[model samples]
Target: MIFLIYGTDKDKSHEFLERLMARFLKGKNFFSLHRLDEESFSESVFNGLLKTDSLFLNKNLVVAKRLFQNFAAADYILSNLEILGSSGNVFVFWEEKIKDDFLKKIKKYAEVKKFDSAARPDFKKKKEDEELFKVADLVALRKKQEAWFLYQRIIMKGGPCEEVFWKILWQMKVLGLIKRGGGRKLHPFVLAKAKRAAGLFQEKELDGFLGELVQIYHDYRNGTADLAVGLERFILRV
Candidate 1:
């Protein structure tokens, strides 16, 4: 059997991986766990998959993260899916996203399951969910502080607005503070922070803050506007 778990949401992906490990490998301290790097991943996975179990166990489980860096590794794994089932060895592959071609090949011989982290519901309303969110948020904030300092340093050294915006976006993306797609909305804390920063703006101006930020992003991307100006406008009129 083969399982492919993937999603853009890291938290959910990690949670799913942990749950699967607990379910399958519980109380089995003899099971081997390997963390493979990009350079050695292909070799590690190949060897791990092909190894014979001596414990008389019915199944050998291999869990790999970010398995394939190139088509060759992916092709190798895809071709061996049938062998996995025949040998009673299960390969569990986890990643953020899989290419369509790779996914198709894997599905040919393996039972494929996808877990999307982004599809999860809002965590703020549930007690367990809220605690998880808070923990994640606190870690993110600490990381953001480091990036924020670096950004300020770069800006002081005459970095361009586009550069700053890119840095900011990267940080926000890491923090999961930015939403994607149409229905995606800003976090309450983010909105509150923005509103507080834009204390100079009137009540009427506040209504257009998000829309203007979107416009600013579009304009900046198209090279028609300066990111610094847009950011200043945003901070001044939030």
Candidate 2:
């Protein structure tokens, strides 16, 4: 059996992989597992699936994460799906996202599962907190828009105040709109604008904003950050 698991939630994705690992570990004598990631893909990728004990006892587990950085690797894997299937290989794959056409071809030989970022467990919770985050995010987004308008206004009017610029910057910081630059540098306003457009400022309030931002930057960078419904209550309380 072949499995294709691709999703934005890395935590849950790893959890699912762990569960699968547990199943194989139970009958240790029945299975032999091989795992690969981007670093090791080039070395052992073309070797295909390796046989375990014997046909009846040959349960194979192949797990790959972030295996394809370019179309070359993806094409290589796609081309070999049939060969793996013919060998009765059980493959498990995980990626952030895969192209529709690639997924279609993999589905023909594997039990394909698409795990969307929105479907992760406890992903949607605390309506009040979510609403608060949304408000914060909205305020941050507006400040960004306002900053652009102000920049244009300054250029047209031929002078802008340090105070006005600082005010916009402060607003962005408080609303968790700005991204800190490497070392002590500040992120460019334009870069901040792009990030806001990409829905990166979904966490609004002070506490939630910091927590979510850290979680996003580190733990679940691949996942989506949507404003939760509970944010409304938090906004009212604020």
Candidate 3:
């Protein structure tokens, strides 16, 4: 069986993958396992590996990290997925991010699992925290309309405006650190999400957003601007 493991939680996704491989190899008499990363992988290499006969091994496992990010590799794998299955190799595709349409298509042939960053235990403890992440993620993904809608919902639920504001700021800070070549101390999951989201805005844009947010907070405190309206406008402008 092929396993397509992806999403924001890189550490857990890799842990799960290792556990799966261990489970598969536990009682095996002979097993063949291979690993490849994006830089070391290509359609030709994968095809040759698939077609090669493993006479001594009863099971085969090929772990590829971010292989689908390459168009040729993705196309080859999608087209020949059934062939891979028939060849008796358990292929694992691990990625931090992937195209939504490709993920949907792979579900038919692969056991797909997504480990969302917001679904962690800490965020699960408070419903509002989960909602806050939704807003933060939407903004990071540049889904401004959805971010504004979720922000409004959080406000209606009496969630602290400052809490949401700080979370967004924190998310931006993480992204800024990534863009500026820092954040080595962050959790693997947080680092991965920040790297993925950093593409949405340039360093100058992030700095501008933070400055605007500071002014908005000042205006709110002085009673010159409605916090909710100011925040909503900020989300749209991002």
- Native-to-model Cα distance after best TM-score fit, residue 141 in candidate 1, in Å: 13
TM-scores of the candidates are: 0.46, 0.47, 0.48
Clashes by residue pair, model 1: none
Pairwise lDDT winner, candidates 2 and 3: 3
Q: Which order, best to worst by TM-score?
A: 3, 2, 1
Q: What is the C-alpha lDDT of each candidate?
A: 0.53, 0.53, 0.79
Instruction: State which candidate has the highest lDDT.
Output: 3
Instruction: Kindly report which residue stretches of model 2 are placed more than 4 angstroms away from their true locations once superposed.
Output: 43-45, 51-59, 119-184, 187-238
Writing each residue's lDDT as its tens digit, candidate 1 over 137-200 gives: 3323434454344444444644334534443343334333222221136567765543333333
Residue 173, candidate 1: C-alpha displacement in angstroms: 18
Query: How would you encode candidate 2's per-residue C-alpha lDDT over 1-238 as one tens digit per residue?
Result: 6677887664456567667767765754466677766656663544635434256775677777777655666777888888767665566778878888888898898876655545324643444234333333444555435334444444343232222323333444544433332212435664555364435444444446445334433322232231221222222333
